[model samples]
Target chain A: MKRKFFSDRDKLEPALITIFAGVFSVLVGVGLIFIVSKDPVQSVRNFLLGPLLRTYNFYYLLIAMVPITFTGLALCIIYQLKYTSLIVDSSFYSGAIVATAIGINVSLPPGLHPAIAMLAAGLVGGLISLLPAILKIKWRANELVSSLMFNYVFYFIGSFVILYYLRDRNQTILASMPFQKSFSLPKLVENTQLHAGFIIAAVFVVLVSIFLFRTRWGYEIRITGANPKFAAYAGIPVATVALYAHFVSGFIGGIGGAVEMSGLYRAFIWQMNPSYAWDGVIVAMLARKNPKFVPLSALFLAYLRVGADFMSRRGDVAFEFITLLQGLIILILASDKIANYFKERRLKRAALSHDLAAQASSAGGQP
Target chain B: MIKFIISVFSSSNYWFIVLRSTAPILLVTLGAVITEQAGIKNMALEGSMLWAALTGVIVSAATGNVWAGFIAGIAAAVVIALILGLFALKLDANAVLCGVALNLFSTGGTVFVLFSLTGDKGISSSLASKTLPFIKIPFVENIPWVGKIFSGQNIIVWISVLAVVVIHIMLNKARVGVRIRAVGENLEAAKSAGISPNRIKFLTLAVSGVLAGMAGCFLSMGYTSNFTSGISAGRGYVANAAQVVAGGTAVGAIFASLIFGLTDAMATYLQNIGLPPELIQALPYVVTILGFVVITLIRDRKELIRKKKLFEKDRAKPLASGLGA
Candidate 1:
């Protein structure tokens, strides 16, 4: 039940395993590029170090990192409760729709306009996400299954809203009218798309970290997640905590979506947008499910994404290869058996050394 | 609305479309049902289908043979299943997360390969991909409404029906089926009873792989003529919910699949009738959530009632003397 040695190794094991998984997967990814690309070394170089070589790519990486960090922070919160509610993806999209609706229609002061839009987005996102949580809590329905389907539902509904109400008849392509100037997120950099959304992301990253580690509600949520039945017996309201987790997560997701839509996009055009929620999933896993580490993970993922973009354009490799790498990283990190195997191996080694030392001492004393 | 409903339901073509639409969902549901019976939720059902669909399209196009594509497609899904088993069973990865990983991999991997082959990101219309043909039943084609509903459907449609029966027999009447159920119900007890859970699970996954592969191939080759990116859409995910609604039975999956099919077909039919297409599109998911909740409530209520009876019986027995002192 207790380890007599390797406590230090046990403490460092998770981080070690994570680094190993990342490096191992990247190597496999490089090998894949080798197999597929005409010039393997150049392709690998572009994939590995392309984002850092240029300022434009660096800014793009930061811009890409913004929304994912928000969603990753949300993921860190919801996943703490250990319930598989994938409503973050839906809520993130809904959040953008809400932001667009408010920004285009509701007139407000310059600052207040974007604020109100973000608040509305968060509210709508939270409400959309609550459906699955409520179903799971009240009826014992599988939240994961319900939420997966709900993503498609919300997406179609949001598109309906966009198509009917917000469509720009002047546009040749399917897209919404641009938001009012007041709704635009304040730009922070001269030649880059960097905006106040990045600052907001930073703020939430710290806030979530504090909320999780310091607050009583956070403690309750953590305990509930760790062992719901035990937490219930110990007087925590497990269901309530779980519900709170979903709402908070959805709020973050919604806000993130709104920020991304307003800051980076020229208009409410969704055709080019990849699901930031999935990117957030990769970020969350890369962060080892820590809110404080979300920024780091987001940056790492952003770098990979930007690198892949460069490689695809310049080195004849597909960007989709990075997605395969991301999936590999998640699987390797989430492999409980693999992690446990390492831990077991270490413990066994420790036990054997302990036995050896004992036998040698006993022989020396007898002699 | 009532008239519209009745008119839609009254048509033999409506039933035919229902069965046809249900075929893919039912195939995936059967895939889900088998895995769920073995206490594994193959979240990779979506990924498996994607890989299969893409493989079927590309291979058939390359070989100019639909059957070759079909076999290769199924084989690809089986490989995914084996990979899932390797990570989930051998390495003790969280099966759900592993499934998610595979789904992600499949989505990206399929696109990567597709882009590599044809330099197209979305559709395979340029390729000479062959589709499975619909057969005309000579004798059954003579029947009136029944013929219209049941006869001359696509080959995969018949395979789906045949699959239902084969899977039903395999799960209910076969030894492996019993072993799988035992493993699902009580892994520890099954192991203690000398059953190898790993072996049973591997077999279950292979079967699931074949079913999901068929569903995937059906979407690309049988239902549609060409491979489109995300052709499976959310059917793979829907099958999971349907399998749950069916209570993990092959027979129950038919009715569960039909329910979704009815809603889905209604979505297609109801689009022109004053309702927004998006609303119609959203209807199936809303129905699924409702069905999921209602079934859970029913099951929970039944459990509560059964527990109350046991409690009452226990209360009727003589109480032991106080032992607190």
Candidate 2:
């Protein structure tokens, strides 16, 4: 079969769509806020432009971005390996549990505290990620189902551990014990919420980019993902790479979990944390699973979340509108086939119009 | 002997509780089976249940009738399922991702509506949440062995049992059921035989929604008599797990559901006994993990045995082929 026109721009189209979709999402979000609140104009202004002005909120925004950065990085790692069905969401939760367990249990000195906690967290997350890999290799169980199911296991275990053993009795609210200074992330800008975790996240982003694009392992991962049979034929251990991809993905997700816990919260606040896993999945998708774009995507999501918080608090709109907007984006992104169909139609129309104009100009010259 | 007897009788309550708790999960399992068999992995069971719970509460409160709530819940769930079906089948959105989207939407939409209608954050109609009446068997109480199983259960439990039998019969005996299975097992084959895969998928999802809706009714109107933000609480996923374990068999689904229910009941029972509530609550999930492992192991073992049989059969076949030559 002959290839159709605009087939070459198929890859480029999604990037354009993503950029436009982001702006469209923001606009729709603003419209929803306006519907609920009296001053639609002011609500949009407050949401879009307000958070950047306040130094404290701005720092909080970056702090929020920290976990997202790690999750996006983790997702990118998995994506670069060519693994689909994006299973890192639950891995992040499992990772957080590991970090929290350490934070609540171990008493380390300040300088090494956060580092050790993060390392412990990554280990747990990576181990959890291995479940799906093992299942896929041994029993031909789908990784997506396995990882999704194991998320509940992680939640149950984490909640059990936190609520039973590590729970802070002094505080009436349900949460874990506060971490020792040794396990906590170091504060960088004295009074600001921005912690050293942000620096670490940035460093990891760069490392992930390098690992994905410049390394032999990365090439192996891509080769396996593209064609497992071909990769196997070429002597690549497809199963091992699949397992390792998840491990690295889970490791980063776990670190992100720990970073969020130590950098921001004093303790494990609830049985569940913010859906950093979902956010990470979305961030990864938005970046087309590109390692280089994870940092930016993570920051964008964090900004949206922080901005939503700021808007709902200051304006009359409910923060639930943020979820509605997120849903719209997901629906659109998942409908990539639909998006491409429209792009094809538009290109065909453009070509026809160009042909008609040329014929009209040629006839006029002959006359 | 005394400890064994005490454990048996005491754990007998555990058995009854397991039966009771399995009701929602069984409904969800049945729903998931139909959808999965139709080649549509309906991840929106949780969302459907949540919305159904909300609608059940709303209709029951409005009409003061539990049946009305039940019907309304099914209708509401179907609406949500249709919306999801539209996006998935017609728009060609990824089914699993769409499921995830719908689940998110359910949480947000329910909470948003809850705030608008009741000014409550997570729950609604505290004064209006009413439990369905439990039916006591009139004559079956006299039976010796069957008496314990027949007496004092809600109408929905009876419906759940009936549903299993009906679904089994339909799946195995009926032409519609055959078509549905064919659609799922091999879409192209079904299409070649004049069955529209898309229509089959949509109808299966709709039926799944109704089943899930009944489960939701069992949750809010049947027992809890309240609507929470996420009252389904991962039961949908549990049902998905159960469906897999059952290999889409209705009888297997019921048994799997009962097992999960027992896990849940044990967790709750342990909590009631002054064990750490969180640890007790984790029991079902731990069991779920174990269940996945066990199911996979059993499958692998069965496959190995089948391969061995095939090898033996092949040896005999080679001699037969040589004799023919």
Recovery fraction of native interface contacts for candidate 2: 0.43
True contacts kept of 1: 0.75
**TM-score top scorer:** 1
Per-residue lDDT tens digits of candidate 1, residues B1-325?
A: 7998899989999998898899999999999999889888888888889999999988999999999999999999989988999999998887888888888888888878877777777888888998888888988888998899888789988899889999999999998888999999999999998999999888888888999999899899978888887788888889989888888888888988888999998888888677889778888888887777788888899988987777777667768332222
Report the lDDT tens digits of candidate 2 across residue range B1-325: 5764456446545655666788889988998888888888888888899889988888888888878988999998887787788889988887777777787777777776665567676677553856778888978867654556556667788888988998888788888899999999898899999999989888888988999999988888766768877789888877777777777889989878877887687676556557777666667866765676678789889988987777777678755333121
- Rate residue A43 of model 1 by lDDT: 91
CAPRI-wise, candidate 1 is medium
Q: Give the C-alpha miss distance for residue B264 in model 2, angstroms.
A: 1.0
Local distance difference test scores for all models: 0.86, 0.77
Considering only N, C-alpha and C atoms within 3 Å, which residue pairs clash in candidate 1?
none
Docking class of 2: acceptable
